[model samples]
Target: IFTSTDQVVQVNGSAATGDMDVLANHTPSIEHIRPGVVEVILEYKSSLALGSGGCTNAHPVSNQHINIVEAAPPESFSPKAVSAKLHGALKVATGNGSEEEKIGSRKV
Candidate 1:
């Protein structure tokens, strides 16, 4: 089990055999990111957020292939992504954002 600080909990790629769990201090490796549903499970004591994506920071030696992967925190994920697998809603607003930017809650 991983805690809140455990960033980049999972990476799902198109060629990946299956979903894999990621934890802190993980061994360095790589996976072929596929265009599939990437679920990022973040544990908030009071809130169980089922979501997508990755953290900005990766271990200098960690196996990270970001280009082929779509990573974002739950708060920024569109209602579709949240509702698709996890039955929940995350409401956010992007003051000056494009459609996708709004989905990711990018402030611009």
Candidate 2:
């Protein structure tokens, strides 16, 4: 268990998956076992596909963007101190072009 002076924590993107735990510098209680620590399990909808679409003699049909975020109590040691990280992949499909070409041409 860790503690922090801040009151909030945030996690973003695909990196927030499965079981996760955080520790902050705050008082611990029965409910807040790990006063500064927070735990979360992030998930994405497998059914939802993100990307673009195209077909034979077809043009750009669609585009999509998906984002996820998680927040927790901040640490007590340094209220101003904050740490964050993000992970995810952008998927795009162009029927006429290869996957590599489609991804390489686009700006991430």
Candidate 3:
């Protein structure tokens, strides 16, 4: 069984116990499944191997595709400049008032 939510794809079930091969497409099932127009692909393969004790073992292998988008760069900032601006604003807003007065004035 396969379940899809947003950009995430999940497969639940035991492939080792099945004989069928499964392949998934990269279109509506995976494309644009989330916030962004990302695409994903999933493939599963299973094989049975013979053991020395006359027993058979099943093995499963899976392949996945993940596409990630690059984020934009952030604007540059100067800590000293920001601090100076904040200090000037606080001084203008508070004047000679006490800390409690300033807090009370800003309360909603």
Candidate 4:
């Protein structure tokens, strides 16, 4: 979703492993990204919401690149809808549900 030649101060992104903050001269590596905001830090910070599929390639010689499979604006989501889903998930998580259901609810 983003391509830049400007100098970056830092970048914050989430992966299946966990969240990570990348800085200039970060070690080269590849990380499988999860669905979350990828914040690019520069003179002014900017962010993009990414879908579940993507990978980050961090190289010392070149800048970090995030390959996004899907993207959507934050405004596209309805807070009320999200809240309702969360409520149901919490109920399943706390109530007498199957083990799989409880674990899945907690993940939600």
Candidate 5:
């Protein structure tokens, strides 16, 4: 659920093969999702690697729990750059993020 009013708030939704967007009050559905970039658009844009050792156990489970996501540590993942960038973005998101931060989110 990414939003923006004053500070840009973006989220890199599931990049997996079957990732999807489940909006509020939307009908429920099941999917076999994969792991990929989960971006959060903000003053400072960044990326992160998903899953274990560059793979996520995001296999299909239940449609009622699509909100649940899985992510691994940077040390264990291969995309170190993306992982580090994600960390930096989190810091800015929680702290004082700059409006001039890079924009990596897509235009809805």
Candidate 6:
């Protein structure tokens, strides 16, 4: 989706191998990204989250193209709140909670 030269600091995405971040001057390579958050870190410390989508990085150094199957406007979240939810979900999923509770925990 990068049409112009917008100094990108880093790009984080979920690849087939694993979740990784590509920094400036990163080695040229291709990756099959899975459906997950793609965070683009800009030069001025600003960032943008491209909601869950799949992509392929043909040539990371030069022409970086992103073909998102689905997208949505980014949203902000609190780390503490997210952590709490995760902890609660884990507790329910691992503990002696009901099946319904464990199933619910699987959601965001």
Q: lDDT: which candidate is best? A: 4
- Which sequence of candidate numbers ranks them by TM-score, best first? 4, 6, 1, 5, 3, 2
Best by TM-score: 4
Q: Give lDDT: candidate 6, residue 74.
A: 54
lDDT of 2 by residue, 6-89 (tens): 232322122223222222222331111211223322232112122122111111321111222223333333433322111122
**Which prediction has more favorable TM-score, 2 or 5?**
5
TM-score attained by model 6: 0.55
Candidate 3 achieves a global lDDT of 0.34
Sum up the clashes in candidate 3. 1
Question: How well does candidate 5 score on lDDT at residue 33?
Answer: 43
Per-residue lDDT of 48 in model 2: 18
Q: Put down candidate 1 lDDT per residue, 1-108, tens digits, no spaces.
A: 233345554543234545665544456655444444444433333222332333323355763434422344446568886475343223334244456646665544
Task: Tell me how far the alpha carbon of residue 93 in candidate 2 is from the true structure, in angstroms, after superposition.
Answer: 9.1
Output the better candidate (5/6) by TM-score: 6
How far residue 79's Cα lies from its native spot in candidate 2, in Å, is 35
- Which is better, 1 or 4, measured by lDDT? 4
Task: Report the lDDT tens digits of candidate 3 across residue range 16-88.
Answer: 2333222432222222112211122233432222211111122232333322233111223467896897786
Superposition error at 32 for model 6 (Å): 1.4
- Model 2: weakest 10-residue lDDT segment is 50-59
Task: Tell me the tens digit of each residue's lDDT in model 5 across 1-108.
Answer: 332242433333453454554433335444444555444334665444344212222223311232335564345656777779898788676655555543433123
Clashing pairs in 4: none
**In candidate 2, residue 79 scores what lDDT?**
34
lDDT: the better of candidates 1 and 3:
1
Instruction: Please state the error at residue 63 of candidate 6 in Å.
Output: 3.9
Candidate 4, 3-76: lDDT as tens digits: 67767777788887899888877899899988877777776766656465699888879577878788776778
Each prediction's TM-score against the native? 0.33, 0.14, 0.22, 0.63, 0.29, 0.55
Model 3 stretches astray by more than 4 angstroms: 1-75, 96-108
Assess the local accuracy of residue 68 in candidate 1 as a C-alpha lDDT between 0 and 100.
27
